[model samples]
Target: MHSQPSNEDRPWTPVKATGTALKGADAGIVIMPGDALAAYTAVAPGTARLTSSRPLCATGPGKISCQGIQEWTVTVRVTRP
Candidate 1:
């Protein structure tokens, strides 16, 4: 019979938070939100889990500030079963 691998032995991969346009704004500017939790959750499922969180870094609101141009930066550790 085949045996399942242990959690400790599972392969792990690091996931980085990627920013997307929260609203209609200039594509030249790059905004990174400090909220790691929010960023982690934003990641697609079955991708990875937040292992470490980093501070937020962003530029002043652009033309779409009213549209909420928030950004996030998060570090995730993804493991495969």
Candidate 2:
């Protein structure tokens, strides 16, 4: 998963990233420094839900309009041939 933080939002951080059927390999999930938010891999036939959230209010000048936080999610389904 990837997140593009807007000017009024802070960077996204991982929240719930765990599953039972699939395992995330080290080689498959590459940690790109200062680039991507997160990476995952599906090593088996199963379903996984990746979620992340960021603060709605970003630190900067001016009046802060946004409050609370925002979230992002993706469901990955892998199958065997």
Candidate 3:
């Protein structure tokens, strides 16, 4: 969660494209400035992935078109002990 890749101009944000095994502690997507700290609760015994994505380049006028994307993932496993 710490020392990960991040951009100040274009920061990395969570991708809720699919269902996740870990549910967010907050009501909705929680993203703080210059930080990606968030809590999640395991709903069931399974494996889940928390992901974040960012464009390769900053999109703006006169800037190079962003043709690629970068992603970061953290795998979480929940089991009954």
Candidate 4:
């Protein structure tokens, strides 16, 4: 999961958002909103839930602004049952 919009901030910066599956990974890992994360997973039949994460740092839109640094950051926790 990765995304680096060429123009993330602008008068008309298209709210870049999308999701894509891995190219060769064999699993149900669906990245959410721009493949920025592995937000969901299907661990087994009829059993699935959202992954967890800790907020390391976040900035953008209204949290914080810089000359050319507009983005959000976080650390996702991978769990297994």
Candidate 5:
């Protein structure tokens, strides 16, 4: 929950996150951010591993109130042309 990134510095990396089921689905899924690289095993529904090639996009610790949620946003040093 704690990171070393400050507002002056951007934190970016290949992110892999895991979620558990809380309701009818019994599991939650990690939706890949649009501006990052594709990670494998996105179909698992309970866990996700997101990778990035450039600093084009950052994610938020977004969450759903009723279903529960968390997200991470980071900036990368790599850039894609």
Candidate 6:
């Protein structure tokens, strides 16, 4: 019989944003670079998945004012060609 897996056994990976930016005035939104891999890995046959721990913040005029420390996570998957 197959054994159940624990959270520690999950295949989730950690990723970070290379940059962050605020977009739009009316609909101001925070944007950041998701998961990124080497060109070789990106061109592989598998899919990449990205997941953020929390919503990014948008500040400045006409945007959501946010302060304090915030964190997020991004995940990606790559396969061999």
The digit string of per-residue lDDT tens for model 5 on 1-81 reads 865433223233444443321112323455344322323322323432333233222234562223222345432222221
lDDT (tens digit, per residue) of candidate 2 on 1-81: 956556334656743565654564454554433222454556767777777777676655673657787687777777851
TM-scores vs. true structure, each candidate: 0.21, 0.57, 0.62, 0.22, 0.19, 0.21
Clashes of each: 3, 0, 0, 1, 5, 0
Please, what is the whole-model Cα lDDT of each candidate in the order they appear? 0.31, 0.60, 0.65, 0.32, 0.32, 0.35
* Residue pairs with clashing backbones, model 5: 11-75, 21-26, 21-27, 59-73, 61-71
lDDT of 1 by residue, 1-81 (tens): 956433222222233433332212233544343322222222333443224322222224351123222233444443422
lDDT of 6 by residue, 1-81 (tens): 956433233222333323222111222443233322222134444444433332234334564544443354444444443
lDDT-best of 1 and 2: 2
By TM-score, highest first, what's the ranking? Answer: 3, 2, 4, 1, 6, 5
Give residue 42's error in model 5 in angstroms: 3.5
Q: How close is candidate 1 to the true structure, as a TM-score?
A: 0.21
Q: What is candidate 2's TM-score against the reference?
A: 0.57
| lDDT of model 3, residue 15 | 49
Please give the range of 10 consecutive residues that has the lowest summed lDDT in model 6. Answer: 18-27
lDDT minimum window of 10 residues, candidate 4: 14-23
**Total colliding residue pairs, candidate 6:** 0
Per-residue lDDT of 22-65 in model 4, one digit per residue for the tens?
Answer: 11223366434323343233232332223322222233556434
For residue 27, what is the lDDT in candidate 3? Answer: 47
Model number with the top lDDT? 3
Tens-digit lDDT string for candidate 3 (1-81): 635334664566754423456776764765565445567877777777777877777666775676787787778887841
| lDDT for 68 (candidate 1) | 25
Clashing pairs in 1: 33-71, 33-72, 34-56
